[model samples]
Target: MEINLNKHISGQFNVELEQIRNDVLKMGGLVEQQLTNALNAVNNFDHDLAKQVLENDIHVNKMEVKIDEACTRIIAKRQPAASDLRLVLAIIKTITDLERIGDEAERIARVALESFNKAQQEFLVSMDNMGRKATTMLHDVLDAFARMDVDAAFEVHQSDKALDKEYEGITRQLMTYMMEDPRSIPKVMDVLWSVRSLERIGDRCQNISEYIIYFVKGKDVRHTSEDDIKENVL
Candidate 1:
């Protein structure tokens, strides 16, 4: 995860770049923990754990603001060009995705406060599985960002398709559950929304992985197919 940012002529500029990079990683770390805690809270039905995740979200938001300000200052004063400029831009976009991911985690934590009947609880097992996968994707993408590993990022980008497939399967299962037991529709909808949050978190992780590739290769891979992204990365 150690990146060499010592290539700049101005040591102070190098330090500034490195500082913002470190801050982004810090923000990413917090977001990762938030997702993990939120998933655990839902699976265990821990109201206190869920409440703690909501409280800690402000810290994630603050980190995004702080790092964003640092990037603006760099752009205003340093006027970084080429790779340096790309790095700053990527950090800006990455933090935005991370913050949104935090918001999704908050949303999932809120589901922990809701009540579900024993029959409705079975669906949560599927949601928990999806949440764990989404959490892993987030962690891997953050690792790729820390190392600036384009290959790792590419792998993470590819992983999202499988997550999407899982989301579809779970949604179908929930729909069938509601059709069979109309009375459970309300509680099932809450679980449905929570799973949707998990799916969105996977999308956010994929976006972050794309940012990693964009920084290293200066290629905009968004809205591109897997074959196209593979060509760009390779």
Candidate 2:
């Protein structure tokens, strides 16, 4: 009889762990969709869509709060230890990063709306590409976390180098535009700010990847080389 009861209790604990994992994934999905929508709004110059993205940020913030509260309750009541503690801690950290990503996307959309009248097609295309790349990085990092895939998480960090290169290119182009035409200076500055926000988003994605590595391997991979990541982390 005691053995059966122990088995049942173990099953219940497993179910709770699954529930926490699902909640984190759902939060990630919401943030990803927000980023996609924000980019679409910028590309299409849709003021209404931008407004919608801004409005939905409130929902993301609420989810972050609720998830944090739930995680706290689980820790206090369940008294999870070791790997279980690591998993819960990772969820808490990831959701915080996801919520910030949502805020960055919303800020970009707001900037898009403000400069919609002045923005040129060429600049808009570049910004859209950057947004897409950043969002893809975010999605991949979340996937890595969900599966505890260290290789996939490392991919996100490598991809961030590409994002940095793109951001530098955009910055150079914007600087040239501002220097060549005095009349274009103000609008170019707005575009520069938008691109800067996107670059920061990429940095956050890299941070998320590092967190995933830590969660899986119990090692901090931040500021570490790819070779070191493999040699030390693996």
Candidate 3:
């Protein structure tokens, strides 16, 4: 009889845990769409779409607040230990990352709406490519978290290095363009800001991937070597 009672309690906790996880995934879906819209706005040069992205930031902010409250309640009531605790901690951390990514997306949208002459339009092509890569990474990272796949998360970490290279190359090209045409400096500066925001979005996605890995393996892999993360996961 006692064994059955313990099992029932465990099952109940599992249900509650799954609910929280599902909510997190739902929030992730919203964030993913927000990023897509922001990138599209930039690529298409649509101020209306940019405004829409800015408006959605409010919804993302509300999700973060709700998720945090739910996590706190679960911790207080369930007193979850070990792996369960790690899951809650991970969701809390990831929500904060998602919120910040939304902020960066809004910033990108603002810069993207600026009027660009011919040369500036040409430079924006590189920015569009960079935005695509970062958005793709965010999509993959969220999928990895939903599936609780540490290997997938590791892939996201490695993918961020590509974004870093892209950012550096674009920034160098922009610097040369400014030197050649001083009149283009203002547009160049806006592109620089947008690229910086996109790069940071990639970084925040990487951080969320790390949290996913930590949730699955019970190991905090931040500041650890790539070899170490691979060894731990695989």
Q: Considering summed lDDT, which 10 consecutive residues are worst modelled in model 2? A: 1-10
Candidate 2 lDDT by residue in tens digits, 1-234: 010111235677766767767777888898899988888888888899899999999999998998899889879988887667777787888888889889888987886586544445566677877887898898899888777777998899889989899999999998887788787777777778778878988888888888778877778777888889978787
lDDT tens digits by residue: candidate 1, 51-158: 999999999999999999999999999888988888999999999999999999999999899987787779789987788789889999999999999999999999
Q: Give the per-residue lDDT digits (tens) of candidate 3, residues 1-234.
A: 010111335687777777778888888888888888888887888899999999889999999999899899989988888777898999999999999988988888887679987767987888888988998999999888888888888899999999999999999999999999999999889889889998998999899989988877778988888888887655
Model 3: colliding residue pairs: none
Candidate 2 clash pair list: none
Report the number of the highest-TM-score candidate: 1
TM-score of each: 0.97, 0.90, 0.93
TM-score ranking from best to worst? 1, 3, 2
- Residue-pair clashes per prediction, in order, are 0, 0, 0
Higher-scoring candidate on TM-score, 1 or 2: 1
Prediction 1 global C-alpha lDDT:
0.90
